[model samples]
Target: MKPLELYLHIPFCIQKCNYCDFLSAPSCAGERKVYVESLCQKIRSYKDLAKAYHVVSIFVGGGTPSLLLSKQIEQIFEAVRETFVIDSDAEISLEANPGTVTEEKLQAYRNCGINRLSIGLQSAKDRELKRLGRIHTYEEFLWTYELARKAGFLNINVDLMSGIPLQTLVDWEETLHEVARLKPEHISAYSLIVEEGTPFYERYGNGKHLEELPDEETERKMYYRTREILESYGYHRYEISNYARLGYECRHNLGYWNRTEYLGIGTGAASLIREERWNEGEIPEKLDRKAQMEETMFLGLRTMKGVSKAEFAKTYQRTMESVYGKVLEEMQKKGLLLVGEDQVCLTDAGIDVSNYVMSEFLL
Candidate 1:
């Protein structure tokens, strides 16, 4: 059986954030209960597919996975265990919101085999949290983090964001300093993109709120400073936006970037099975070899490790030079790419303009 990663989405939240466009909504107790049952059914329905794969990682992300009762979480895991051969050391993670978690609930999660907790603490400033429509304050997050640690969760990830309306360089630096002081196992610092259809878009889209936002130069400074600050605190940048202590990188996400086969369950989730990509409950679109090659370069380049020449040649049965020689030569000349003996990776400047650099790999 092939090794696989699993992601289960819980689409219920106490409240949705202004910048979030994920499928989630405010739900009541009865509604949550109903959703849990449906989610369990969905898990059980994958028995056939489960037989052909051994589960290596399980990430329970969502609207707010921590909002579910311990019993609900256990039920979902029970369904998974019954269907698949889970690795003894599988990384089982749950995404949590600080406002919704308590000591008892966290302890329950630990008992239910959740070895990792990812807390969503977008900003260390209360004002910024409020502005982002997050229900928890910085203090609440601290309390929740302490509770998780008390509950014996050594593997933890804290989410932080940069770039917001009314945010300054000092504010961003302060947030980083405060989070780094806590010394979590991992940190994911992402730049704020004003995606369409969210409340943030209505308020800031189309340069409407540009005045409140830090200028491009300031944002770029914040990005580079994130790496310098986090690395100083013993966190290494394994990926562009992800910093981690040794052996603490998120295996589930690495699977996604490495093009490993994964099964995504629940509303609006997506899955990549072999060379096919599809949303939940839809037919997968099979990708041809050229498309696969393009995806490999684009996704792998997002990491500090970049793409492996040997692995690419082995998989495609052709030299990397045969496919991307010209592109690599052009990018290297521009100082946007580094062609090491074994791997080809993006340079610091390339990472800043990664969208354009990655586009060049498309067939």
Candidate 2:
């Protein structure tokens, strides 16, 4: 049977952050109970598909999955196990906001087969956390992290953000240093983008709020500094925005970059199955060879490992050079890419402008 990853989106949050554009909302207890029932129904609906695939990973992502009662989370997992052929050693992860989790909840998650915890603690400074409209204070995050550790969650990830309004390089550095000291198994450091439709966009998408935010040079410095500091703390940069201790990379996300088949359940989730992509209840779009190649390069190159030439040839039945030879040569000459005998990867400079480099692979 083919290996597959599973993602369940829980769209309820205590409050929406200013910069978030994901499908999420503040929900009441009654509404949450109803949503859990629907989510379980959706999970059971996939029984037939489960026969052909063994679930190798499951990620309960959010809004704030931890907002749900522990029993509700257990119900979702129960439905999944009943319907799917779950691998015995599958990596099951739960996304928790700092203030939303408790000792009882963490213990319940462990009992229900969740072995990893990803806590959203965007900054370690109270002022920065407040500026981002985060619901949790830095102290709350520390409490939650300690609770997870005590609850036997050996594998944990901390999420951090850079480039908020009124944030300085010192603030970003402090956040990084503080998180690293906690020694979580994984870390995801992302730059804050003022996405369209987010509250942040209304205030800062244009030059109107630029002075309050870090300048381009400062933001770039923050990005590079993240790599330097994390690496210094024994965290390896496995991807552009992800660092991990050895053997601690997020398998569900790796499934995405490797183009592994996955099923996404719940409202507004997306799935890629059998080379076709679809959103919930939508018609699948079959990917052509060119489209697949573009995905293979751009997604795979996001990691430090980059694209493996042998795997690319095996998948497409054509050499990587046959497709992106000219682009690779140009990028290499410009010191943006490092083309090795077995793999092609982006240089440090290339990663800073990765959007443009990845776009060049589109045909």
lDDT of 1 by residue, 295-327 (tens): 999999999999999999999999899999999
Off by over 4 Å in 1: none
lDDT scores in order: 0.92, 0.93
Count of clashing residue pairs in every prediction: 0, 0
Model 2 steric clash pairs: none
On lDDT, the candidate that comes out on top is 2
lDDT of 2 at 340: 99
Residue 164 miss distance in model 1 (angstroms): 1.3
lDDT of 2 by residue, 1-363 (tens): 999999999999998899999999999999999999999999998888888999999999989999999999999989998999989999999999987888899889999899999999999999988888899899999999998898899999999999988999998999999999999999999999899998888998766768898999999999999999999999999999999999999999998999999999999899999999998879999999999999999999999999999999999999999999999999999889999998999999899899989998998
TM-score of 1: 0.98
What TM-score, over all chains together, does every model reach? 0.98, 0.99
